[model samples]
Target: MTTEPPETGLVVRYSFLWPREHDRGEIEGRKDRPVCLVVPVDVGQGAVVVFPITTQEPLPGRSAVAVPDTERRRLKLPGDRPCWIMLDEANSDVMPGSYHLVPLETHPLRYAYGRFSPAFMRVVLRTMGESIRARQLRMVPRER
Candidate 1:
């Protein structure tokens, strides 16, 4: 049975394994960090599509995007930790509990670091689209 995501395009903390890393083996360690749940891959499969987030600034060659400080604050991210979205790396089979979803409303504590606003989602999608078009040479239709 295929399990769908509770919410598509939700940003949460998850441990992601970079598929391209051939040297890494039996890697039981999963790096838990911020990731954007792009879709469920049907928005399902007990799995979802994800874009890894990091604090490392994109260098002259890395295919990553910077998340503005303002947007990061709205996501209730840590003030001390800067964030960058990795456009080249995406995990398509992240399991449930691998990440989280912040709904429209949440408890004060949760809201401090919960599901982000639609506005931010727009920014993510836009950047992801730009990455795809320039790097992948393809077009991605907007979900809505």
Candidate 2:
């Protein structure tokens, strides 16, 4: 339970600002939600990127990876509905002092809920990579 996110694949409660919201002139997320940290592309540089997780079904044409039931049980995510890791966009923030990384109310002293399994993360990363190569990835800056 660290105050700062130390690695990738950690599921954290964050104020995730979506691409649509950003386009509508919203600087902050509509609400705090569960997000997965799938890539540690530049940990030493403090640039952490995260993909939002939602129980809502992905819109048509958007890319996403389904979260398995076992994974959901391990993480104790609320509800019994299906969840998906939206891969069409990501948010970047400087770690150790990110404005959008909110502490989980259930784990007040920690910034993360838990880490995703390596296997699941692999699937997520692969989908994200495809999005990246196809140039469908949108990077929204969340740093102040």
Candidate 3:
């Protein structure tokens, strides 16, 4: 028996939030601290993906995880900090919710299951961005 490879260009929505001052102590000294945010997409909605920007290689196979635009503006992520925007086509049953930071160093192999090329990932990001923009336009209230 053989398993099919994951699909490419699956559009998944994700949101990321940083920890408050109170929570800083919990992740002291850790750079890529686990963050919790919302994923609007549902299982089988399309595919799971992430947009991670870090100094290290991205964890494989994991779904797309987006870095909050606010964080990007404030921190100005360094280039050496390898940024990853992952997507997972499997496990669509899980609802969009929050996830804690699970150190990549801990489960190197498991996280590095699926990999995507820079060009391919760029295409995916562009497609998703267009879709999001369209959706936002539709929601805008028309002025008479």
For candidate 3, write residues 18-128 as lDDT tens digits.
Answer: 133214444222344321111335444423333323334435533344544444334333332434443222112122221322324444322222233345546555645
Give the TM-score comparing model 3 with the true structure, all chains together. 0.23
Which ranges in model 3 have alpha carbons more than 4 Å from their true place?
A: 1-109, 136-144
After superposition on all C-alphas, the RMSD of every candidate to the true structure, in Å, is 7.1, 2.0, 17.5
In candidate 1, which residue ranges exceed 4 Å CA deviation?
1-5, 20-23, 40-47, 94-112, 134-144
- Model 2 quality (TM-score): 0.90
Listed in order, each prediction's TM-score against the native is: 0.63, 0.90, 0.23
Supply candidate 1's per-residue lDDT for 40: 42
Candidate 2 lDDT trough over 10 residues, lowest sum: 1-10
lDDT of each: 0.56, 0.83, 0.32
**Candidate 2 Cα errors over 4 Å, as ranges:** 40-44
Scored by lDDT, model 3 comes in at 0.32
lDDT by residue (1-144, candidate 2, tens digit) is 235644678888889999989999999999899898754664547777889999999988888999999999899876799999999988987766777877777767777778889998889889998988999999898866
| RMSD (Cα, Å) of model 3 | 17.5
Question: Which stretch of 10 consecutive residues in model 1 shows the poorest summed lDDT?
Answer: 135-144
Number of backbone-clashing residue pairs for each candidate, in the order shown:
2, 0, 23
